[model samples]
Target: MRSSVDKAAVKMSRRWKLICVPTVIVTVIICFTSTYLLLVKGTNRWGSGRGLRVNQNTRRTGVETTRNFSRIGNREEKTRENITKVVDREQNKILMTNSAAVAVCCTDLMNLDKDKAVIIGRRRKNKGFLTIGIPNTPRSFGKSDLKRTLKSLIQNTPNDLGQSHVSIVVFASALDQSTRLSTRDIVAGFPEHVQSGLLQLIEAPRSFYPNLSALTGSDLYNRVKQNVDNAFLLAYAMDSADFYLQLSDNVRAPSNYLQSIRDFIKQQGGAYWVTLEFYPVGFTGKLFHGGGRDMQQLIHLFTEYAREQSVESLFGHFKDLNVQLRDAVRRPPLFAS
Candidate 1:
C-alpha cells in the first residue's frame, strides 16, 4: 500500500512539471516576438520622417532657385530691348535735323536771285580777253613782287595792244596790310591809257581766298559771282556777260600774251587753248606753258567726260585732290542747265 501511494504521487508530480515547462516556453516566445515587432516599427517611422523632410526641402529649394533665374532672365531681356530702341531713336533725330538745315539754305539762295539767268551758246571771237581781278588776300604774294607784277602788266599791256582794250578790275581791300593806300593810288600808278581802261575798283572783303583754284571750290565765290552778275545785269540791263577772265596777283604778264590770245581766239572761234608761259626770275626767258581755259568750258568738258566714266576712272586721270571740285566737275554745269 505505501509503494503504490508513492508511485501515484510521482506520476502526478511528473505531469505537473511537463505542463508548466511548455506553458513557460510559450510565454517567453510571445514576449520576444512582440518586442522585435515594436523595434522594427520605430525604425521605419524614424526613416520615413527624415526622408519626407529632405524631399520637401529639395523641392522648395529647386522652386525658389528657378524663380530667381527666371526673374534675372526677364530683366536682362527688357534691358536689351530698351537699349536697341534708344539707339534707333537717336539716329532718326540726327537725320531729321540735317534735312532741315539743307532746306533753309536753299530757300535763301532762291529768293536772292533777281531772275533766272539764261545760258547762251558761246559766241566766236577772234581774240579772247584775260581779265585779271586780284582780290586782296592776306600774305598771298610778297609786297615788292606784287607791285612789280602789277607794274609789269601795265607796261606790257600798253605795248601789246594797239589801243587800250584790255579789261582789268583790281579788287582791293582797305583792310589789306599790303594795300594800305586807296584803290585810287594803285590805279593812278598805272599808265594813263591803262588807267583809263580800268573797268571798276570794287572793294571786296579782306579775307577772300586769292587762290583761283580755291575760289573755284568755295561757296563765297559763287555768292560773289551771283551778286556781281546781278550788278552787271543792273548796270548794262543784260542777262549775261560775253566773256569770263581769270587773273593772278603775283604773276607778271608778257607783252605779247594778249595779242597771242586774240589771234588764237580769232582762229579757234569761241574756245581757244590758251596757257600761261612762265619766265624765270630776272631772266624774262621761257620757263614753260601752263594754265588753262575759262572755268566754264573746263567744267563743261569735265562734265561730258564724267558722263561716259566713273568717279574712280576720272580722279585717276587728273590725280587732283579737290573732292568738291571733282564732284562738281563730274556733273553737268549748274549754270548750263
Candidate 2:
C-alpha cells in the first residue's frame, strides 16, 4: 500500500511541470514582437532625418548659385556707370572752352577727336584765321600737291565764316594699343592751332555681339559702323557742328586735305558734304554698300564699270543703291560729284 501512494505523487508533479513550460514560451514571444515593432519605428524616423538633410543641402546650393549670378551682374553695371561718368566729365570740359565752330567725326585713332580740334593758339586767341584742324591720320600728299592744296586753302577761306573749333571723336578698341601709339605721334606733328577737344576714348568691354562669329565683310562693317555712329550721336547731342568729315587711316591724302575741305565748305556757304576718293591698294577692292549713304555711293561708283548710258538706268541704279536723295545726281551721274 505505501509503494503505490509514492508512485501516484510523482506522476502528479510531472503534469504540473509541462503546463508551466508552455506559459513561459508564450511570454517570451510577446516580448520579442514588441521589441521588433519598436526597432521598425526607430528606423523609419532615421530615414526621414536623412531626407531632410538632402533637401536642405539642395536649397543651399540653389541659393549660392543665384547669389553668384547677381554679384556678377552688379559688377558689370558698376563698370558701365564708371565709364559713362568718365565720358561725361570729358564732355563737360570741352563745353567749357571757347568753341566757335565744331566738326564732329569719329575715327579709330586714340587721340583723333582731341587732336583734330581747332582751338585758338595759347598766345593768339584773336587770330581765328590761323587756326588749324589736324586729323589723327592726315592724308599723305606729294610735295607739289601739298603745296598747292595748302595755298588754295589759305587763299580761299571765306571771310564770313568766323573762327571755328574742331572736335575729333575717337571710336577704337582698347586692344589696339600699338595703333593708338602710332596715331598719337602722327597727330602731334600738327601746328599749335589744333587742340584736343574731348580727350576721352570710347571702347566696349565685350564684343557687341558675342554670340555670333565675325564672318562676312558686311557684318563686320556694320558692327564697326554702329559703334562709331553711337559715338557720333553722343557728340551731336552735346553740340551741333559746322560739318562732319569721314576719314580712315588707310585713305592717304595730301597733308593739306583737311584745310582744303574746311576752306571749300566755308566758301560754298557751309552747306555741303565732302569725301575723299578711295581705291583698294590691292587689285580687288572690297567696298561698303549699305552701311551709310556716303559709303554706298562709293560702292556703286566702283562696281558699275561703265556709266549708265541712259537717265533711266542711272535713276534705277540710284534706287537700287537706296540713295536717300533720289534726284541728287541726275542724268550722266556726274561721276565725281
Candidate 3:
C-alpha cells in the first residue's frame, strides 16, 4: 500500500510541474513582446523631427536642440529662395514677350498732361470715336475688377463699332510699385487689345495733388479729389471721342449696353449728356455726351459744386442755374442790342 501511494504522489507532482512550466514560458514571452512593442512605439514617435521633444532643462543648452532649430531655419530659408526664384522666372518670361516689350517702351503718363496721353494699340476707323475712362485707386480697385470690366466692355459692345473705334484709358493714380506692376500684368493679359491700340494705360503725375492736405478736411478733400479725378478723365475722354463713357471699376455692362447708347443718341439728336439710371439704385454718371462747350462748362461747374459744405445746397444752386439757362435758350433772342 505504501509503495502504491508513493508512485501516485510522484505522478501528481510531475503533472503539476508540467502545468507550471508552460505557464512560466507563456508569461515570459508576453513580457518580452510587450517590452519590444513599447520600444518600437517610442522610436516611431520621436524619430522624425516633426514631433521631436526636448526636455525643458536640456532644451536650453542641448546641442541636439540647437541643431534641430538650425535645420528648420535652413529649410524655411530654402523655401523662400525657391519662391523668389519662381517669381523672377515669371517676370523674365513676361519681359521677353512682344506685348510686354511694347508696354515697357510706352511712355509713362503720370507726368504727361491730359492732351499728351500716349496711345498704344491699333486705331480703328469708324463713324465716331468712343473713349471710356477708368480711374483706379489701389485701395479700392484691383486686377480682377479691371479684367472683368474690360472683358465686359470688349465682349458686349456692338461689333459694328469695332474695338478700334473704342479707346480704354486707365488712370492709375497714387498706386504703390507693386500695385502698378500688377496693373501692368493685368493689362498684358489682353494681348490683342494692347497690340491693337484700343487700350491705353496712363498713370497720374506724382505732383498732380501736391496740396491735397491743404484743400479741405479729410472727408471733403477725398470728395473733391474724386471729383477732380473724374473731371480730368472726362476732359481726357473729350480729347479722343465725341462720346465719353465714364465707368466705375465695379460696374458690369449689359449685353446690349452699346446698342442702347447708339439708339439713345439718335433719339436725343445728339444731346449734351445722356444720364443713365440704374434699376432701383437711381441715376449714375455712366454715360455722357462729350458735347463740345456745354460738357466742358458742366464739368467745371460740377467741380466747383463739389467743394461746398452742403451737397444739398450745391445741387439746389445747380438746379436754379439749369432752369435759368434753359429759359434763356428757349426764349427768342432780341434783335439788337
| Candidate whose TM-score is highest | 3
TM-score of each: 0.33, 0.28, 0.51
Q: Worst 10-residue stretch by lDDT in candidate 1?
A: 328-337
Which tens-of-lDDT digit does each residue in 100-191 have in candidate 1? 54344323322333222211112112232344444433343344344555666666676444233344555443344446454446555655
In terms of lDDT, which candidate is stronger, 1 or 2?
Answer: 1
Per-residue C-alpha lDDT of model 3 across residues 15-34, encoded as one tens digit per residue? 99999999999999977765
The regions of model 2 sitting more than 4 angstroms off are 1-163, 168-174, 194-240, 251-323, 327-337
Q: Global lDDT for candidate 3?
A: 0.51
Give the range of the ten consecutive residues with the poorest summed lDDT in model 3: 328-337
Which stretches of model 1 miss by more than 4 angstroms?
A: 1-130, 140-144, 158-164, 174-184, 205-241, 264-337
Using lDDT, rank the candidates from best to worst. 3, 1, 2
**Candidate 3 pairs with clashing backbones:** 110-205, 120-197, 121-196, 121-197, 122-196, 122-197
Clash totals, every prediction: 3, 5, 6
Best by lDDT: 3
Clashing pairs in 1: 126-265, 126-266, 127-262
Query: Runs in model 3 with CA error above 4 Å?
Result: 1-112, 119-127, 139-144, 158-160, 215-217, 269-285, 302-306, 309-320, 323-337
Better of 1 and 2 by TM-score: 1
